[model samples]
Target: MKKTLTVLIAAGALLGAAGCSATPQLTNEETCARVKTVVSAQSATSDKAGMTRVANQLRPIKAAASEDLRDPLQTIIEYFDEAAKPTPDTAKLEDMKADYSAAGQTYGQVCGTGQ
Candidate 1:
């Protein structure tokens, strides 16, 4: 009974880890920006492992961002030579910002600056 219970607990932990590892959708700009930030942070930090820890902590922030190609009005005109399409669910952007901020806090806790 003790062995069976331990196995069940271990299996549950593995399943939970697998489920948590699923990647959230992110926008192209967000991905690029985050990658750039991580790379820059890596270069600036002396501890490679520590920098990696910080980057990993911030992954969800980048994942939570969207890349649906919506831009501010002027930037949209500059890129597509027309107005950018309006997003129906703009609140997600705010959520993404909050996620990023939380990630920043996590990074700061772990890496001292969170970049």
Candidate 2:
């Protein structure tokens, strides 16, 4: 009984340690690189299914971004999210385009892309 309890405690400790080790938040450079990759991938694909796939890929990168990059990433995410909606609204689409353009400008300024 004592041996079993000891083994259980060791297992619990190992699990606790693993859970405590969080993934490091992405730096600005890393975030920008990931964003660029996503953009390139998105641009390369013209179909609706491919766009949806790329949008899904952006979710994790958005979640991993540091606080400084969150707003731009969110804008990008919103652009895709709005695009993916079943019933599209013209006004909302226009707003999303403006927001996306603003976000792109911000991203360009920060990352020095001149876009």
Candidate 3:
């Protein structure tokens, strides 16, 4: 019984250590590179499917992003998500365009991109 308890405690300690060793937060440069890759890959596609794809691809990147990068990434993701809907509202799309552009501008500035 004592041996079993000792083994169990050892296993629990191992698991606790593993749980505490989480993935490090992405650096701004790494996040920027990933965003650039996804955006560049999806840039040519303007259809609903493409928009959805872009949003989906960005979701994880945004989720893992640093605080400073989150808002612009979210804005871009939202724009793509809304654009992907069937019969997206034209006026709404127009309204979102400015924000989208600004977000893109923010991303470029933050990421040091020529985009």
Candidate 4:
């Protein structure tokens, strides 16, 4: 759980992700902007609750995101979902960090962020 909040905050801070079910297909720029807006508006509080919320919020964005963003968003969602579990598997969490980092880098590239 210690690592959960850390990764959550890192992902949120770096990517600032989200989208809605009602959202239409978005251009890459629009998707990036929407993600930043959604995440900034709802800052995570507790580890489990926050990670779960983040995962839930990101699913729709993944569905509507540009092709370049789909894989990264899916990876991020998987990270958050694993972190939100009551007893996150340490080995899994350890293995996931590299992928999460890669996803964050992908997000930054796609969104044109320095992060």
Worst 10 residues of 1 by lDDT: 73-82
> Candidate 2 deviates by what RMSD?
2.9
Give the residue spans of candidate 3 off by over 4 A.
2-23, 42-44
Off by over 4 Å in 4: 1-24
> Number of clashes in model 1?
1
* Model 1 per-residue lDDT tens digits across residues 10-77: 99999999999967766555544654475576443535445445445444554464443222211212
Per-residue lDDT for 9 in model 1?
Answer: 100
In the range 1-115, model 3's lDDT, one tens digit per residue, is: 9999999999999999999886567888989988878878936378888778888888889888877788999998888887888878889889999999998998888898777
Per-candidate TM-scores read: 0.26, 0.75, 0.78, 0.74
Better of 1 and 4 by lDDT: 4
- Tens digits of lDDT, candidate 2, 27-105: 8899889878877873536455665667777788878887777788788777777776676676888978988898888
Worst 10 residues of 3 by lDDT: 42-51
Q: Which is the winner by lDDT between candidate 2 and candidate 4?
A: 4
What TM-score would candidate 4 get against the native?
A: 0.74
**lDDT-based ranking, best first?**
3, 4, 2, 1
Q: Which candidate should be chosen as best, given lDDT against the real structure?
A: 3
RMSD of model 4 against the true structure: 18.3
Query: lDDT scores for all predictions?
Result: 0.47, 0.79, 0.85, 0.83
**Model 2 whole-model lDDT (C-alpha atoms):** 0.79
Candidate 1 stretches with Cα past 4 Å from truth are: 26-61, 66-115
